[model samples]
Target: MDVTSDEVEMETAPVSADELVEAMRQAADDAGFDLEPEQLEVARRLGSLAVGEASVPAHLYLWGAAGRGKTWLLDAYFQALPTERKRRVHFHSFFRALHRSIHEHRTAAAEAARATGEPGAGARAAAGAVANAVDRAVEDLLDEVDLVLFDEFHVHDPGDGTLMIRLLEALFSRDVSLITSSNYPPSGLLPDPVYHHIFEPGIAVIEANMTVVELAGDTDHRRSSAVQRRQGFSRGTWMLTGQEADDELADLGLPRPDAADAVTMAISGHEFRASAARGGVLWFTSAELLERPTSVGDYLAWAAEYDRWVLDALPAPEHLTREARARFVHLIDALCDLDVELHVIAATDRETFMTAETLGRGGFARDAFRTRSRLALLRTVG
Candidate 1:
């Protein structure tokens, strides 16, 4: 566990992944996580990877149940790594960016072919141009990062699955080291029966390029029975409709979100315009946060960075479309996972909010239940 300054500062020298994991474990323990025995063993395996002790594959792919600390471990490992050219990304956001890049590249390639008087350069030239564009995009995007780590890896879109094959090939060819955490095994990716084959090649790439490590566990540590009561969940009696909610927030020393100005946030190259953000506290209306096509990855990124969040005009699930409600569930899950202090201005009293007619409506019903549970812990302020 006693890593020297040289080990921590190994400029251009490769440090064993086990050493990084060991350091990460110590840091997590110091920060109060009860280090499970299996977690330590897995860290050792990951460290073995950093040192080339593993013979088959060099990259790492860790998978387990939700809330099993796969993200937590990757976070720690990413922080502990001394490598300067390392990047950590939420997998969903990464794919979103990748999709955009692919489109942009294909468009540019088409434009280039047209400029050369080959508007009908035919399929072969067009294909060659696209391939070159993909190469350029990948090179430019990852020009700075030698190691790329992805959290919450999943393949739900067939488009993303197809793109993954090319992206992974490019990264592997460049010898970019990889570390990923996922809920599903590579074989379990894109479980949609109809379009799963689109990702088969991508899955094969993962199998060939990474050493899959399973972190088996049952309990979700984030929601453990013995979870320590945390600060920052607060509620009020009055519906968060008018001036009353502002008064309540002022009483709790939080900013008045209505009067506060808006700020734009760019996550994974996508623009997210927030209604109010101040002093590391971000504020949003229910519509702004949920009605849009926001994913948990965006929330996760924000939660990791911001210490406080204020969500005003949080509507009951009944008031929202199914998609909006599902997104709300995802937001709560990310906040709980990161243990971020959340201040909400709910439309109704705490009890009514939990028992709304739309409570158990969607595929996210379980997430809704957990969100309600976490919300219950918030202090009622009015």
Candidate 2:
């Protein structure tokens, strides 16, 4: 089926639910996803939602293993939805922007409280200010957005569980519908036993308000796939550090920094050690990146500034601190989301680098599954 841009735009203009399913089928083909039975079921359900079918729930929570096509199905359907009032956000950048905006609102609110010239005014206003900050931030972030698609959603961090609850509440209050994909089911989120109970209320809201579906397929699709694209992360490679990796870098005419080329640069109020910038390429060792407290926002900032990134001297995952391992996962996530070219050099094979023992505790197991799947797109040199 040859779909013209005009036809796509026409489809987007308030199609019937039946017509929208046809549009969604076209979207799946365009996205190059082989629609499994489970995926098709979810996609059809999501398509039915474009027209707000009365029988359809207001929100959807699709959960599955990383390679089960949860993200692909949701994204493809989102593109085909017949509405301009929709927003799609990746979890990392979405949370980063949310945190930043809430902080900005709270600062302004606190300043106003201070200027009132009343004793304990700032202290007294802090509670209400937080609520206002959340409301204002959500209002700004989701202006006229009736539908939101949240990709790669997870609440692994204990500290973030509360934040997620607040965000869900805000979205509910505004009557904004949501479609989200996640590696874990609602009960499996924030898997830290100590903090699991704290998210129960949030889970209850989801259970009450959203339709939950599991896309359970046997295949690890990413692991079985080969690189078919010449741009973006698909064009990248994973290789053991050696002359072979260096030769490929030279063949691609990409930058590879020597010790003398490394330098420290400040970005987004955080310092990062990188190779001397060459055109749009930047290089850093795993230690320089993962050993520090660099945030997902910092990775996003760097990925934005540099089109290509080279990561070298990646140690075994077992050797790194849990924090460092988590940082690497976030780094891969940000880079993959932006489709930034990344060349990673590791000391061992991907399997050995991501052993069960290496991933340790918390929600790292599932999160690592996602990171590993993304890396599987990279060309591997044994």
How well does each candidate superpose onto the true structure, as a TM-score? 0.68, 0.88
What is the TM-score of candidate 2? 0.88
Highest lDDT against the true fold, candidate: 2
lDDT of each prediction vs. the true structure?
Answer: 0.66, 0.75
Listed per candidate, the RMSD to the true structure in angstroms reads: 6.7, 4.6
Q: Which segments of candidate 2 are over 4 A away from where they belong? A: 1-12, 30-34, 50-57, 111-128, 356-366
Per-residue CA lDDT of model 2 for 22-72, tens digit only, reads 766777677676577887787777766733434443788999987888777
Question: Candidate 2: what lDDT?
Answer: 0.75
lDDT string, candidate 1, 81-100, tens digits: 66666666545445545545
**Positional deviation of residue 175's Cα in model 1 after best superposition, in angstroms:** 3.0
Supply every candidate's count of residue pairs whose N, Cα or C atoms clash at under 3 angstroms: 3, 0
**Model 1: per-residue Cα lDDT at residue 96:** 44
Please estimate how well model 1 matches the true structure, expressed as its whole-model Cα lDDT: 0.66
